[model samples]
Target chain A: MARPDQIRFRRSTLGEDVYEALKGLVLEHSLSPGDRINIDALAREFAVSPTPIREALARLEADGLVRKRPLVGYTVSPLLTRAEFDAMFEMRSLLECTSARWAAERADAAHREAVSAEAATTVAPQEDDPDGWHAAFTALDARFHDLVAEASGNGLLRDGIDRLHAHLHLHRRYFPYAQASATVEEHRRIAAAIQAADPDGAEAAMREHLARARERHLAAFD
Target chain B: MARPDQIRFRRSTLGEDVYEALKGLVLEHSLSPGDRINIDALAREFAVSPTPIREALARLEADGLVRKRPLVGYTVSPLLTRAEFDAMFEMRSLLECTSARWAAERADAAHREAVSAEAATTVAPQEDDPDGWHAAFTALDARFHDLVAEASGNGLLRDGIDRLHAHLHLHRRYFPYAQASATVEEHRRIAAAIQAADPDGAEAAMREHLARARERHLAAFD
Candidate 1:
């Protein structure tokens, strides 16, 4: 489960940013769920001491990205359970729908333009480069949602959605090209509603998209 | 600014409970906003080594309850800004209103009974024992809201609300006896609606209560 570039820390002389690098590994599933972290091995990987790795792990433990038992050290958190997945989608719908409504009503010119630009970018997976395509596709998808949240003009709502642990790894394995295309269409609908300054329409569109996304994610379990 | 009981770690023989004790200090405002944590002082207070104290601070930083800087160690997070307070209230209204509606629609007999019990509770702050009374009053208020959220059957919604970093300290100092009573009456209205299985009534009551609460908290900034 190890790769040479698994966790490419910037490796500042002062240990400036090991935390973000480590967090990226966990979020991207390079560390893999339920894997016990090997601090010494990671230290060797970066040609640094173990202090920075341990420090990063401590912070990750608090973020619920990792768990620390008395003797077990730390393990990346298990994948989201079915019940957790359902509840999170409920929370997402509640927040994101409101975000869309607010974005439609009050977004500035910049936020509007930015969201539209993000929504308009769409692509299908390449047969020979599926991994590369999936990476670009999901990155764009996350940015689209984040932009809508930013346009909502509510910092708390943005932060709330930001904290929800994203299960992008599930998409890498289970999400098909057809579903990816459908998701882009959903984004375009949401963007159109926002561009029209139609709060009700934006909210309704967001609700529909989230309901469908929930169903799509649930298919992973089946 | 130190209280003998400020940290009050359970002092497990294994040093297992230090993180919780440290988190309590920050949550209760005993550590105070923007106060630089004196790890050595805290270690001495708990009669433990500095290792546990440092460990807990790392976790609190991840929780956004504390901040760390280049040359500086950890400091408790600053109090919420007026904008943050307003945004958080908006989020609270969204989630709590949904929780109330769900409680009305689908709460089992036990959840209904528990919510009714919490809502029926009422009290006024005693002038002679204002601190004592405020403690009991605010605790009950938190419990009442938590019970309704639990009754909603959405663990993610409940968890989102819990992570909002309660500013109960605002209530202790700024909220008065009449306001305390009014808050209880509002709780009763919400509880009664939920008990009666009226989703519209419960949602409306919760929305109204959150609006009033927003106004109450705004008084702190003014």
Candidate 2:
């Protein structure tokens, strides 16, 4: 039999495990947007109590991935409207531009190395593996922005950008990975500017990249 | 005795009630930073189970107020380091300036009215009621910023600013209200610029106000 301490440790991590599981369910569309989450059913499925399930849902709610109403329990947050999309892009322009500039000015050697590594590894994802390619590109894109945010040398700034990116990931999942080649080149420009410690160049490059990304995403609606 | 539906309805709001209670404790410093939050203790204190307490802590963690650890449990997050403070101010400069510009451009009659009302209501808080004065000033300051953020016509932007402000409130509670007169004048400038729909003027005014605020806050460290 497991020791008492061992059992306690396992239980302690149960909430975190449930949080990750629910997040996966939401992102993978196992729990579609606007789908009401049956808390008791989830607890039974996961073989845990309702406490952990409720805790997990609360964290998800804060992520803007889920919604909770009085007496309504939890539901997956609905997809962003076009206006929300525009607002997100506008926010990105303000934040990412500032992040790029700070990354250029404050990035240490490790941060520069991270930027270089991301640039070197990026390539044109294959069309045959659409699902796999999408997942891979999404992760790579996230890493690139994450590295820049970290390099900004501002914890709150990094966290704000991280949360914004987390919200964007949902909308991004539905969009095509078109303009991969163009984005790779754009990344190179951003990387170059950061490496050279050219804050203005870094800011401008990020702005241009986001402007293009907005154009590409807007095409989805049309 | 309450009916079955009424019982269910009461149970539904338990988590929200617990959340507010816990938040008050943290904001009031009844639960000081680094203090361990015993789940069972809270459950017993509130005369409820641990489920709602866990949910409330999860949300607080997302707010960057409470923190969770593996094997251990929840604790109030530590005070912000100088670096963290600088990071927050930098983020505010980017976000608030953009928000002010947008408020100037996009604010309808209702938003303009909110700004005017808040500005008109301002007065130099009396010294004897420092606690009351502080609370009043904080609320008015929050309303001024919130109005600008709402007038930005971007939900995501407003939410981002709101969360950052929530985090800053912890640090700000320690600072004095010495700059109230200067701040009132600054608010006037920002409100006038927004009312006039001068985006550039509003942006510049906000940037200047934040710069001064930053200077005032930095004095706390000296």
Candidate 3:
């Protein structure tokens, strides 16, 4: 059996790898917002043909990380404006609250266990191990939300929630651990409600968590 | 200024035409559900190179009209099953209700006119002119929903609603004019609520319309 790290040996196509690399560049602002992407230049830098780069750019455009013009090539999409951020949250609230309500009623034992485990997990103080803690925190947080969405048993709703969260992640400013405790506690409350099969409670808790999350991120717009 | 028909005379790049043509083929079931799409064959058929076909397939894949695999080629997605139809209606309810509420509060004069114009217009009769009347009904129905979404002024929500409706269209069975009156009257109720700037009324009316629409379409599953 492959070890945890050895899972990387699983063959992914070149296109998938290229897509990830290009997405990283955009998310980390290496390819800064509104920067035009030159297909030939990227091809030279990646030491491959422009085909994969073009494919990746098209996928990224679908993901809302970039935009393409008719005759002109692709450009990194500008950061989410303050107004867009509110719209994003409103969309999230509509989907996730419904997901939580459904998940409470529908989640089977396996999904219930998964959601609980993810919610109970937490990051150590980032002062000692900033990068490791930050990655763990983000992944756990994302997984908890995704698990709830999955447990809702609605593919359309789950896909919408997942994509909106990814879009929200792109707008996040880099930061460490300050609100980690509050966020984790909120997840626990939501998870508890779902596990208890309290549909209204789960929905309300999710709504509260999203409201708080919006408050936490609102400063990034400034 | 160009006439409505003359708008098509404006030049579009090869890729745009290819994309639209391919989308039409899928929606009309000319390319039936689960049919594999061959780039080379499609290029030959369309009298274009394989490059444009590949680009169009990728765009169609993004639109949920087709699926692509790593080594294998693209295939049209299967029709929505009964379960998926339920999920689709659920998602539409969540997004469109929010849109209608916001549109009620936010719609400007132009948007109000557009929504009213679409709702007020109707197909005379399909007994003599089935195809033209069917086309008119579909376009007007779609335009009304889109106008409300646009009037909401929430790009993310609007785009989600638009994409879902297109996805729904792809699954539709060809029929003519039976439910047109009921659907149009429901649309009128929703429009009246929005026109009156009553957010709660608009939301409730949209929700009621969606529930009835779902009931109307449920027999297709059987």
Q: What stretches of model 1 exceed 4 Å from their correct place?
A: A1-16, A46-51, A165-172, B1-16, B122-124, B165-172
TM-score of chain B of 1: 0.86
Model 2, span B42-133: residue lDDT tens:
99999999888888899999999999997688899887778788878888888899999999999998998788678777756777888777
Give the winner by TM-score: 1 or 2: 2
Ranking by DockQ: 2, 3, 1
For every prediction, compared with the true complex, DockQ reads 0.44, 0.61, 0.52
Q: How high is the lDDT of residue A60 in model 2?
A: 91
Chain A TM-score, cand. 2: 0.89
Which wins on lDDT, candidate 1 or candidate 2?
Answer: 2
Counting only residues 3 or more apart in sequence or on different chains, how many pairs clash (N, Cα, C under 3 Å) in candidate 2? 0
**What's each prediction's TM-score?**
0.86, 0.91, 0.91
**lDDT by candidate, in order shown:** 0.79, 0.84, 0.84
* lDDT (tens digit, per residue) of candidate 1 on B1-222: 777866746344233467788777776667788889887898999988877666677766766678877556778878777666677788888889999999999999899999999888766557898767866886798899999999999987887776663643422246656687788889999999999999999999999999988778677676
Model 3 alpha-carbon drift over 4 Å, by segment: A1-12, A128-132, B1-12, B127-132
- Model 2, TM vs. native: 0.91
Q: In terms of DockQ, which candidate is strongest?
A: 2
**What would the per-residue lDDT of candidate 3 be over residues B100-135, giving only the tens digit for each residue?**
999999989889778878889887885788766766
